[model samples]
Target: MSATALATWTVVALLGVMTPGIDTVLVLRHTIVGGGRSGLAAVGGIAAGCLVWAVASLAGLAALLAASTLAYDIVRIAGAVYLVWLGLSAIWKTLPRHRTEGGGVDALDAPGVSARVALRAGFFTNLLNPKVGVFYISLLPQFLPVGPAATAWGIVLVAIHLGVTFLWYPALIALAARARGVLLRGRVRAWMERVTAVVLIGVGVRLATTP
Candidate 1:
């Protein structure tokens, strides 16, 4: 990629990374409950997702999905269901008696999610989101040059985007981790869990209802 093109892609990547979204919320929640390790796991998961989207874009897979209604619907529903499942799981964990067991564990004791699980969740979340496919099929290509180098350059651009996202999320996780003390207090922790549950559910609902 040319210097100007690389710079422009960097700026776009940074902007997209900084924007708060479901991934951001999920990472923050993990940070608050499980500290830096969990936060990193979440970031890794999200990066895995981005990589899948990047590859799909390069392979023209996203374009094929975009052109097929049945394919799009299947992926969209799957994404919606996954988000709802996550939200409900969060809510269930926040129930009065269940709250103390999971949320109050030390970061080390919990050790957060397994790397493989996180990566898989991250990959599928982004891969299954039709919106992401559309973005890759439409928006990303607009910035790519034509010819044999297009796919290669697109991969580089996506790497830059993922780098920004990975960098940004850790900062967010650190900030949330610092607040762990306050968040761990009985009522405060409970409230935070409740809030996170609601946010997850809202995102799920929105995804399900969106056209």
Candidate 2:
């Protein structure tokens, strides 16, 4: 690909990475609950998802998936359900629970979720969203140089997207970490989780309803 094409693609991909969405929320929440390590774990999960979509897009698998109405509906429904489940779970965990024993510690402050779980959360969340694959299918083609090596150019573009993500995520982690003092506190954390839950559910509903 020409340098001009690459630079344009890089700018577009970087903008997508910086956009606020479920991915950003997941990173922020994990960081708030489990610190920088947990945040990076989630970032890794998202990167895995991006790489998978990138490969799938280059292989025409993403196009095939997008072309099939039944397949798209199946994946879309699954994604919607998963998002709703995540939102409901977050809200349920926020509700007051009685202690089985006297002097039980308050578990509201730190969510106590493990890094692996956070990693899985990030992976499945993005993997289920066919929108990512659809996006790659549409976006990568525009940057391909006219040649038999179209797939090669696709890979290059995917790499650019991943590179932009890598650059953006650490900054996101740092920002989330810097706000740890106020955001991770008991009542504040609870409220934040509540808001996140609502947003997740809303996004799911919108996805399910949109054509």
Candidate 3:
């Protein structure tokens, strides 16, 4: 790809990463509950998920998912169910029984969103979302360079997307960490979880309903 095209693709990818979505919320949720380490683990998982999609796109697996309605529906339903479950679980943790047992601590304690769990949450959340694969298969082709080297260029473009995500999410984690004093408070954390949970559920429903 030309420098101009590369630059444009980079900008687009950065914007995509920066756009607030389930991925962003998951990172923030994990960070709020489990601190920077857990947040980073989530980020790592999300990055792995993206890498999987990139590889799938290059291998035409993503295209297969996009082309086959049955495959797409299966992944979409699974993603929706996962998001709803996460949301419901978050809400469950905010209940009276869970809170009275402890106060200041967040989900890291309630149901236990340990680093490993966060990592798995991040990975599966992205992996199950068929739209992600569709996005990759559709978007990557536009930026790929022509000829036999195109496959390699696709990887480079994906790397660029992942690079942008790494930069953005870490900054997000830092920003949340800075506000830890207020955010970590029991009431505040509970409310934040509730809101995030609602959002997750709503996104899940939207995903399920949308074509």
Candidate 4:
């Protein structure tokens, strides 16, 4: 691909990364509660999901989801349910009632789960969403340079997408980490959790309602 084409693809991929959605909310929530490492794990999961879609798109499997309404609906509904469940779980845990002792930096800084578990949370969250597969199927082809090495070109494009994630997700993690002192406060953490829950639920509703 020419420099211009690469630049264009970068701009588009960055925009997609910066879009605030369930993934962002999840990362932000985890970052606030479990610090930067947890958030980064989620980003890894999101990246892994994108890569999986990239492979599927290359294999022509993603096109099947676009053509088969039943397959699309099944995946969409599952994603919606998973998103809502995550949102509700966040809301439930952050309720003011669960005021455990030592409600300070130590508790707030602790990982909610193991790193592997956190990673899995991220992997499943993205893997289960068919929109991502469909998105790659549609968007990647537009950026592919006409050549015998089109598959190689496609991988490069996906790498650009992953590059955007690396850039955007870490900055977010750092920002959340910087605000760790304030986020450690119970009330602030509660409100943050509420905001995350709302975002997740809103995304789920939009996903479920959208065609």
Candidate 5:
């Protein structure tokens, strides 16, 4: 691809990354609960998911989701169920019995789950969303250069998307980390988690119900 095309795609990808979505809420929730390491792990998983979609798109796999309604609905429903489960879990953690003595930072530790949970949440959240596969299959070809090198250039475009994602998400993690003291306070953490959970559930429902 030419420099201008690459730069244009970079800007488009950056815009998409900067737009708040499920990925944003997941990163924020993990950062508030498990700190920067957890948030970074989530970021890594999301990037991995994107890479998977990119590779699948290049292999003509993502087109299957776009072309087949059955495939699309199955993934959509699965993604919805996963999001609802995560939301319910978050709500469960905030219950009275689950609360630590004074609802301290220790209470917000996410109890039994490790940073890997966040990583998996990030990965599966991105992976099960049929829209992502469709997005790649539809948009990627537009920027792909003509000829045999097109496949190689497609990977480059995806790299640009991933690169933008890395920059944007880590900066968000850092910002959340700096506010850790206030965010991890008992009530604040609980409320933030609750809000995040609700948003996740809402988004999930919307995703499921949308045609």
Candidate 6:
């Protein structure tokens, strides 16, 4: 790809990554609950998801999804369900007596979550997000050249997008982690958990109902 094309893609990817979405929420939740390491894993997963979408778009698999209502519905419902489950799980943890322990930097030092679960969550989150697939199918192609370099440039653009996303989430995670000390005490913790739970559920419901 030309230098200009690469630069343009970088700018576009940065802008896209800066826009808040499900992945952003996920990272923030992990950071607040589990600390920086968990947040990083969440970001890694999200990036992998985005990469999956990019690959599917480039391979025209996303087009097939767009064309088949059944396929689209299947993925959409599955994603929505997963999101709702995640949200509800967060909410469940907010129960008055329940205390979340481990599963953060400390957990990372130990056995921690399986790599498969992390990668799967990341991949599925992006893959099941039809909006992301549509975005890649539509927006990505506009900047892509129609030549032997097309696929190569497409991958470059995706990598840039993933990099920007990764960069953004870490900053958010760090900020949340820093603020955790103040937010983790007294009613603030409970309130924050509730708010996060509500936000996740709201987003899940919206995704489920949207056309």
**TM-score, per-candidate, Cα-based:** 0.88, 0.92, 0.94, 0.90, 0.95, 0.86
Cα lDDT of model 4 by residue, 25-124, tens digit: 7787777787787889888988998899899998889999999999998888888888888778777776545545566423432334355656776887
What tens-digit string does per-residue lDDT give for candidate 1 at 11-109? Answer: 988877788888787787777766677678878878877778778888988888888988888888889888777767666666555533554532222
C-alpha positional error of residue 98 in candidate 4 after TM-score superposition, expressed in Å: 3.9
Best by TM-score: 5
Lowest lDDT 10-residue stretch of candidate 4: 104-113
lDDT of 3: 0.87
lDDT of 3 by residue, 95-136 (tens): 766764444454334354688988998999999998889889
Off by over 4 Å in 5: 101-106
lDDT of all predictions:
0.74, 0.82, 0.87, 0.80, 0.87, 0.73
**What ranking emerges by TM-score with the best candidate at the front?**
5, 3, 2, 4, 1, 6
Candidate 2 segments exceeding 4 Å error? 98-106, 109-112
Of candidate 5, the 10-residue stretch with the lowest lDDT total is: 104-113
Question: Per-residue lDDT of 1-211 in model 6, one digit per residue for the tens?
Answer: 5788788888888878888877777777666656677778777888877777888989988898878888877788878887787668666666654553543322212122234444455567776788888888888888888888889888878878888887887788778888977776666666776787788788778888985
Structure candidate 1, residue pairs in collision: none
Would you give me the overall lDDT of model 4? 0.80
Residue 157 lDDT, candidate 3, scale 0-100 = 90
Better by TM-score, candidate 4 or 3: 3
Please say which candidate is ahead in TM-score: 3 or 5.
5
Give candidate 5's whole-model lDDT.
Answer: 0.87
Return the lDDT, model 5, position 124: 93
User: Model 5 over residues 41-62: C-alpha lDDT tens digits?
Assistant: 9999899888898999999899
